[model samples]
Target: MSKKLNMSRRDFLRLTGMSSIAAGVYTIPGVGGVLAQDEREVTIFFWDGPPLIGIREKALAPFDDAYPGCKLNFTSVPGGPASGYNDKLFTSLAAGIPPDVFIIEIGLLPQFLADDLLLDLKPYVDADDYDLSQFPDLAIEAYTHEGGIYGMPDNVASIAIFYNADLFEEAGAMMPTAQWDDPEWTVDDFFSSCEKLTKRDGNRTTQYACDVTGWDKVWQTWVRIFGGQLVDDPFYPTECTLNEAGAVEGLQFYADLRWEHGFAPRPEAMAMGTTALLQTGQLAMFYSGSWAFPNFREVDFNVALGHYPAGPGGRANYVYYYPLVVPKTTEAPECAWNLLKFFNGPAMETIIREGGLQGTSFAEQEKWFVTDPLPPANKHVMLDAARHFVAPDPVLTNFGEITQIMQAQIDLLMIGEERDAKVVCDEIVRQVNPLIKEGQWRSG
Candidate 1:
């Protein structure tokens, strides 16, 4: 006979606590607890800067106007250098004092979701009378885990090619086009163009062909172009494909521009101001995420945008979706939901456009695109890049750790220490698979 299965009181309370939290209702004091006063205020904690500040403020405006005494208290957390934000956010959660709504970057979203720190906003989102289709399915899907919705997206970011038009003209090369997938005009064309665009001193001192400087960022682009991935699958921790033959080929291609072709600056030399290199008319091409648009525009040079050069796989690219998620410790679930919906609505168009963020909503993007025309290179280049970009699958947990592992091994390959790609792949799997297995997964 099978014995009756019963849960301990502590287990039951834990389950109940999770259920309440997932439902966006929690019992706490002052924070997510019941409001004693007649007028209620929602406290939101998030990063400070032009990109987020603009989005949060515009979204909360209509809510304040509609609800009268319902005010939004915006708290500014330390921003920049990533580590500061991560440490502070973790400390708050550990102290059981998380904000009602917070911004979650793609790289770190998995950590919070796995720990059940985020609320499932499905019910609120389902009841809202808004056009969810305006946003990409990829953006919505990124925040989802184990069949439940944990967050709503604020930005759909992709790595695109930003070139200096005046620099390109100086090199006497034509701008890249949508048919970058065509072998005749893609890989070889891109590097050859960079070679021509590269400038050198009379003493052969130094200058720039392309400012594709960052190690991990450039590797991600090349890995996809060769049809390889950092990990085999998001949910399963089986094997790593980083050292795959294809991936190695991709890395070599990147390294060749620096080592063999003598086009790019040496690693140590690029340590100085990179953007300044572009502004001074020393660099021709810079590949990076659309988030850098604002930073790049600050330069005195004329800028133009284009899609990342495609490979044999056809129009390969990478994107990141930053989500706006409500935490389980939220004091006002209803108010947070109301403000979140408004943030993703029409009002957001103005905020995102002015802030120079490429968000998840096409309508909002189009609004920004119309007003802030792409500088000379290609006005519609952003839309073109969006067409083929692929973000990392969200099923992977502790994404920050995984990238760190991949990057460490990738550095070996980048520096010619690991000539065989398969060897690198094998070592990565041995190092990270156990960590993935030991991780606690929430009901996806």
Candidate 2:
């Protein structure tokens, strides 16, 4: 581990000119580097969240080796308010001692942008020799608010349907395809297939055809298949378009998997551990994101990947990508920018390859669809899913709140509490409309 310099609030404040009392006095203890001439030190604040994999020792080594004399300091912090890290960050920023750079999910970008806490990185992209074309378009679009770019593309989390190949083979069903225009399976085809593979011992279902949770991916995918946007527009995020005909049909389809069709895991059985159920062959299929891919890979049974089943609208997916950002409070914006560019550039490709992580870099995007290290049958599913993928509503700053309502409404529909699709859609619209209207909408 490299030696890290101690950065004090008073020292940074003095250097940044927050205190006007001491004018033209460039004498601050322990300030250095590109920003300052004489041995100045730059301290950066980094999130202690699971997402910031680069902050780890092995991942940070290459950057430190490349950029000698530059020092990076990190403070460990949890991810959420429930973990009290949010409060810690608030207090630090309020005291003008926030980290130089922090991690913000692309989903949460609207909130930080509205608050004016993030530094615009459009100039940095233009100034450097960095290849902006190397980053994934979806990742770029996610962080680009209005006309400005706020962050570099980090790792992306995308959803893919995980299925048991043994089950499919036994049921004599063909695997799902990644071809968007001509998907191998439809929504009804998927349900019926799952239903066929499911095993029942008495009244209780011994094996579930699918495990559908109240997660964002499933809901968004449903809306996409039914030809409805999660919001009215793609560029500017807005209200619960879930009330729309297509969206309601999607939601109902999701709910009906358990209640109407009995092809999914029962509400009570879901908490018994989905991973275990899948591994034990009790669940034939699981709808989840790529982040959970590693977990399922270790199972003894053979696993396969498939695109989300097609509905009336053909094929669609709920795409998720995270963008990296530099906070406005950082002491070394230029150095931070350099580091940001380096990671998004080819230098990070080495890390991605070594880490065995699924990413959405431009170079890798077109190739993933054809890769066959996964289950032999559904080779091109992931890259195929990217097309016709619907992003989360980009306008609303309150993702947490909106997801809460989405989950709640879906839960009600799943449990048979809400049978009328239009009524549920109307209720979702009523709950979400006001929140969307009040938020600062992002521009196309």
Candidate 1 versus truth, CA RMSD in Å, comes to 11.6
Residue 348 of model 1, lDDT score: 70
TM-score: model 2 vs. ground truth: 0.83
Which lDDT values do the candidates have, in the order given? 0.66, 0.67
For candidate 2, the lDDT comes to 0.67
* Candidate 1 lDDT by residue in tens digits, 1-444: 999979999999999999988556434447343444544577666675756655656555667876655567776665642747657766777888777777767767777776778888888877875566676666676677777788777666766677788777777876666343445547767877877887677848355777545457567677677776666665444556566766667766776676666677666666666656666776676676566666665666778777766675455666666788888767678888876776677557666666566766777777666567545345455654554456455355665677677778766655656655566667776787775654436442
TM-score of each: 0.82, 0.83
If candidate 2 were superposed on the true structure by all CA atoms, what would the RMSD be? 7.1
lDDT minimum window of 10 residues, candidate 2 = 23-32
**lDDT for 330 (candidate 2):** 74
Name the runs in model 1 displaced over 4 angstroms: 1-28, 31-38, 50-55, 81-83, 178-185, 200-207, 235-237, 294-301, 374-379, 415-426, 439-444
Give the top-scoring candidate (TM-score).
2
